[model samples]
Target: MSSPFIVVPTYHELENLPRFTEQLWTALPQARLLLVDDASGDGTPDWVKSHLLYQKQLFLLERAGKQGLGSAYVAGFSWVTAHLPTMEPCTAVVQMDADLSHNPDAIKDLLGALDAGADLVLATRYRGGVRVTNWPLRRLLLSLGAAQYVKLITGMPFSDPTGGFKAFRPEKLGELDLEQIHSDGYAFQIEVTHMAWRLGWNISEVPITFEDRAAGVSKMSTRIVREAVWRVPWMALHRRRLKPRTESAFAQKRSSS
Candidate 1:
C-alpha cells in the first residue's frame, strides 16, 4: 500500500485552509494532510475543527509559539516518520504551503517524479514552464538568484533549490541526519537538500507556478536572505561544496544583488 502525506505549516492562515483542504482532496485522494500550526491567534485550530472537510482528512499539531517554516516541517516530519513508519514500505512525505503557492495540480507531478524512482521531487518555478505570479521583480530575482547560487556552488541540478513544495520517499527518512540540519528559514530548505544531494539521493524537479500569498503578509524578510547568504557558504565549507559549477553565474547574480 502506498501512503502519501502532506505537511502544511500555518500561521494566521484561517482564510486559506478550506481551499487547501479542497484542492488536496481533489488532487491526491490517497494522501493525508497534516497542518502544523504555531498557535495562530486567529482561531486557526478552532476553525480547523469546525470545517467538515478539514475535520475528516486533516490532522493538526499545535506548537507553543510561532516556529519558522523549517522547524514546523522538521517537527511534522519527525511525527510522521515515527507514527507512520515505512518499515513496511515506501511512503511519500510531501510538504507545501497552506496559502496555495504550490498548486494542487502539481502534486501529481511531484508524485510521478517519485514514482519514477527519485528520492525527492521538487516543485521548481525556475524549471521551464513554471511561472511566478504577483511577485515583485526584485523578489523573483532574489529567489531565483538564491537557488541558482546553491546549484552553482554545490553543482545541484535542481532548478528551484529553495522551493518549499516537495515530496520525499519515506524510506529516505532514515538518511536524514536531523542533527546536521540547523535552519529555521530558507537555510532549512537549503541545508536539507544539499545533504540529500551529498548522500547521492536521486532528486527531480517538476515545473510549478509560484504565486505570492493571497491573504497574508509576506513572511520572508531581509534577515532570511542575509541568513541564507552566510549560512549557505558556511554549509558549503562544512559540507565541502567548494567545487564551482562552471564559474557560477549564480554567484555573480548573488553578489550583484
Candidate 2:
C-alpha cells in the first residue's frame, strides 16, 4: 500500500514546524508532507524551501496571502490530486493543524482506520470523554458547545464534528467538489465531514489527545465563531439530496441507542 499525503495549513507557524515535521516523519517516514503556507512573514516558506532542497518527500505550496483554512486545504488537496501520477502514489490524504495542537503520533491510528476500510477517519477528542490539554475552561466549554450545536444543526453523529485532524481516502477526497466549499474555520471542518457523511462514506472516529499550541497565537476570532454560527444552518438548508453509500458504525450505534 502507498503512503499518505499530509496537508498542513500554516500561517506564522515557524516555531512549531520543525518539531511537527520531525515527529510526523518519525511516525510515518514514508509519508509526504505538504505545507500550504499563506505568505507567513516568519520565514516559514524560506525554511520549507531550504528543506525542499534535500527532503525529497517535503513539498511547499506558497499562497499569495492568508487565505482562509478551507481554501488552503482545497488547494493542497487539489494539488495532490492533480500531481498524483507524477509524485509518489499515496492512498490517503490527511489534514491537520500546524501548531502542534494535532499530535503527529496519532496520525497512524487515523491512517490505520482508512487501511481498515474507512473512507474518512476523524481524530476526535470527545469520543469517550474530553481529551484536551492547556485549554482554558472558557475555550473548552466553547468547543464542547460547538460540537453539540453542529450535531443539532447538521444531524451528523460524529463526536468532535469540528475537529481538524482527519484522514481521507485519496479518491474519496477527490470526489468532493472542491470549488463548492466556501466555509472557513469551524464551519469548514463541519462542511467537509457533512459532505462525506451525506455521500454515505464509511466515516469513523479515533479518539485522540489534543493539546493547545505551545507556540504561536491561535487564529480563532469572533468572525470565525460567527461564520460557524450562521453557516452551519445554511449548510443544512442547502445540503445535497445524496444519501450515504453505507451506514457508518457511529450512525448505526446512534440509531440503536
Candidate 3:
C-alpha cells in the first residue's frame, strides 16, 4: 500500500545512508523513502540499488551530475507525484537531508503534527533555545542571523525558515508551481515555504535537536548564502506578480495558531 513519501536529497552520503535509512524505517515503518542522489561519486547509488532488493519501500533517483539541493528535491517531489501519486491514506510528503544531521526519530513528531491538522510541518532548530549540537558558535550565529533576515525581508515567521527538515500534505504542496522553483541552494527551502505561505497553507513547527553531520562535508557555500541574501527580497517584491493559483484561506493560519 502507498504511504507518506519521504524525499531525502544526498551527495556523497554513503557513510550515513545505511544508518539513517534503518532508523527511518524504525521510526515510520509505513513510510516510503525516495533517495535523490546527485551523482555522489561515493558509491551511494550502488548501495541504494542493492538495498532496494530487500527494502521495497526504499527507492533511488540517480542524477547525471551533482545538482544543487533544491533541484534534487524538486526532482524527488516530481518523481513521487508521478510514480506513487499519494493514494488513499497517505497524504504527506516529507523532505530531509540524507546525512544524520536531521534526526530520523523526529520524523514522528513531524508526521504527528501533520496528523493534528498542520498543512505543513517544519522541524525547527530554533524553537527551544537553539537546539543545535556540534555546530560552532559562529556557524550558529550565521544561521540565526539569516533566519532573522528572512523574516524581515519575506515576513515568514518560521524560527527556522531555511531548515531542510520539513513535511507537507501532498495536496497542499501540489498547489505550488514546482517546476518554476529554480533556486539551487538553501534558498530553495525558503522559496518553497514562501510559496506555501502565499497560498495560505497552515504551517507549524516542531522543535528538533539538529546535530552536525555524522559524515560527509556540508554543501553550504558562498553561492548558496549569496542566493538567499538576494532572492528573499526579490521574492517578496514579485510574489503577487507571479500570479499563483487561487489561495486557501489558511494563509494566516500559521500566525494565528
Each candidate structure's count of clashing pairs: 0, 2, 1
lDDT of 1 by residue, 195-231 (tens): 7787778988888888888876767878788889888
Model 3: worst 10 consecutive residues (lDDT sum): 246-255
- Alpha-carbon deviation at 137 in model 1, angstroms: 0.9
Give the residue spans of candidate 3 off by over 4 A.
Answer: 52-55, 86-89, 241-257
Off by over 4 Å in 1: 53-56, 86-90, 241-257
Off by over 4 Å in 2: 52-55, 243-257
What are the TM-scores, per candidate, against the unseen true structure?
A: 0.87, 0.92, 0.90
Worst 10 residues of 2 by lDDT: 244-253
Which candidate gets the maximum lDDT versus the true structure? 2
**Per-candidate RMSD, Å:** 9.5, 6.8, 5.3
- Of the candidates numbered 1 and 2, which has the greater lDDT value? 2
Pairs with backbone N, CA or C atoms under 3 Å apart (clashes), candidate 3: 200-251
Per-residue error (Å), model 3, residue 153: 0.9
lDDT of 3 by residue, 96-139 (tens): 98888899889889988999999899999998688999998988
Residue-level lDDT of model 2, residues 1-257, one tens digit each, is: 47889999999999999999999888988888889999999999889988843358888999999988999998998888777755666878899999989989999999889999999999999988999999999999999999999999888999899899999987676567767888788989999998888878899999999999999999988898999999989888888565433443333433676
How high is the CA lDDT of each candidate model?
A: 0.78, 0.87, 0.83
Cα distance off (Å), candidate 1, residue 61: 1.1
